[model samples]
Target chain A: MWTRIRDFDRMIQAMDLFNSRLGGVFENYQRPRLSAGTWGVTESGPRTNMYDTGENLEIRVEVPGIKKEDLSVKLQGNYLEIRGTRKAENPEGYTAHRVERGETSFTRSFTLPSEVDAGKVEASLKDGILTLILGKAEPAKPKQIVIS
Target chain B: MSERQDVTVREEALSERNRQIPTVAPLVDIVENENEILLFADMPGVDKNNISINIDNGRLALSGVREVKPVGAVIWEEFADVEYRRTFSVPQSIDVAKVNAELKEGVLLLHLPKAESAKPRQIEIKVG
Candidate 1:
């Protein structure tokens, strides 16, 4: 009986180890068990955050190790599309032991809550993050109504 | 003994759940050569002041924090403020004083040079 109890304890510990190994496997189908990169975004696309203000809409994306020349953006009405490719950064003639930083092509798109002026859109890149400021169209801008 | 083990297991699981900021290990690449070891890590949106590197007793620790501040209301968010943490065990022969690091496009490049005594040397043979 004592031996069986000890076996039970071992089994429990083994199960715990197994669970940890499978960490976040079913959390998101697009995300691998191990993060693709530091961002931990979906494989088909980079992680993105969108915000809406009265005058404009702001969109931020995590795109590390990517060059400005390799990224492209498109805007039409309220639709926005982003495409980029992260080429391998491995230095020539260097032997790699572990390569985990994400280096893959991805395409991501989004629809804004209101129409935006493509001509007035402003985009900037800093520290590998992309920020887009889209000016809302005149008709879409929030308006206040005064009571008489 | 089993009772104590059960308590420890529960405590470990609860600690991560209560953390306000999620912590993740940054993806890295390790390469080595005859002179030094080169390590590259991906850390986007992290400022230079937020990165910390520590080496002690044959262990190296790297950590960085990314803070995201958004204006107005959020429509959808797939990422946010996070803490990047990772550690590695390095050889004691590494020249800690001579170690060099640089950041480019949110990627960190670290060079750990080997001490002169640890570098490989070729011996000469003479006929007597």
Candidate 2:
């Protein structure tokens, strides 16, 4: 019964989220309407857990058909950029019986805080997921001195 | 016409007794740490060859599709309701370049770390 209640609550929440357009700017700008020959792209962005810590900030994104080599990331001063494109497979041979995939390319960037060193940044890709490691600069590290 | 067909497919799935297929990908979870952030999502039918992630202008986007081909005359249909679509606005503190993504056992995990100067430090204590 509790599980059912929770499921019902989630269903209501999903409906409310779907109907609400408060923070759906992407849907308005990036996503195109569905139709024949629309040639739309799938939507990819921050799935969840977009947070930061006192020492370092962390971000996670979901990208399902793209390869790691095809992705590139760059940091310029206080801004970070992520760019990638996904291509559709050859649909000539098969009837495509059902195509639930959207063929869209995307680029997203974010500004960094003053505390960011902008150096010592490392990234890796495994199993279609990207992970980045940013080391703090020496100046930003905590130090202690004897009081005279 | 295509939209109508999608609706009909969903209706057919609903009419089935054991319809547990998903129209949308499962909710993804993101956990933040001092050096990196971890993301976990359930994507039953998605493969590495089809996932794509983009972060630009404070907007983060995640999209993918699970191609389910109908066999013979489509006696019944479940799953593959529509193409997946989801996006979010990322925090400004992230160092986007140092990000990575991996998919395993139908779950995609992403790691994004902060810039060097952004990471926290431990202050040493001096007892004189």
Candidate 3:
């Protein structure tokens, strides 16, 4: 029983250490900082989701407060690139108390695992989410042989 | 008074349920003027139909459900299914009845007007 208790105590300490490290990572992710501009690029990148539908692949990205006219999507071979900028607009007579959102731009690129039909790509933006559907290229079927 | 108490309890329960979901606190920008206060929150994938906003016991709560994924085999994902939730303490000077909100392109804009009593007024100087 004493040995079991000691093991449990060690486990709890390990968990506590892990939790503190996770907290530090989260804090860094949540904190916003200002940095010098580099060739008109923003430091932070938007979060994304990608899925495979057997026949097609879909990619979704979160980009809030940006107009559709400002976004650009391009596909080069198996790589897909999305770029956009969110402009800052503040009312004239208001005093800001907390300013977490700002004018920023990002360019994110993804390399698809499978070859896609470039002609069949479709993109849409709704509720600040951009979705891209890329149809996969038809794969060559294996040949079957019958022998006596 | 009991009815008000019941409402508070119900709201608390709802907030507790909101906490149970996989939620992310959205980035917000708050501004204040003499007439009103404005709050802007970035909540991607949330639409007007899926968002809830309420003020109870001087707490302003915002919650929304975002359907980020479709039915498919996820090959790669940087973010999981996310719900958005955030709360702020509202001052007594706010006129709750006049509060207004608008959702556009997954961003929420909230306007909380100040009470009449809280507005600044200048008294006329009497000439002797």
Off by over 4 Å in 3: A1-42, A140-148, B1-20
lDDT of 1 at B125: 93
Instruction: lDDT for model 3, please.
Output: 0.76
Top lDDT prediction, candidate number: 1
DockQ for candidate 2, C-alpha atoms: 0.02
Identify the leading candidate in terms of DockQ: 1
**Per-candidate DockQ versus the true complex?**
0.41, 0.02, 0.30
**Global Cα RMSD, each model:** 7.2, 25.2, 9.8
Q: Could you give candidate 1's per-residue lDDT for residues A84-139 as a string of tens digits?
A: 88888777766888988747888888888899988889998887789999999999
Give the alpha carbon lDDT tens digit for every residue of B7-84 in model 3.
Answer: 333222221122223455777889999999999998888878889999999999998877665747887665555567
TM-score of chain B of 1: 0.82
CA-lDDT, candidates in order: 0.78, 0.52, 0.76
Each prediction's TM-score against the native? Answer: 0.78, 0.39, 0.73
Over B1-128, each residue of candidate 2 has an lDDT whose tens digit, in order, gives: 36443233322222223322223434455556676656555564465677788989977777655554333232222223233446766777788998788776445666767778778888899998
For each prediction, how big is the interface RMSD? 6.7, 19.0, 8.2
Tens digits of lDDT, candidate 3, A53-105: 77788898888888899899999989988999888867889999997888898
TM-score of chain A, predicted model 2, versus the true chain A, to 2 decimals: 0.57
Clashing pairs in 3: none
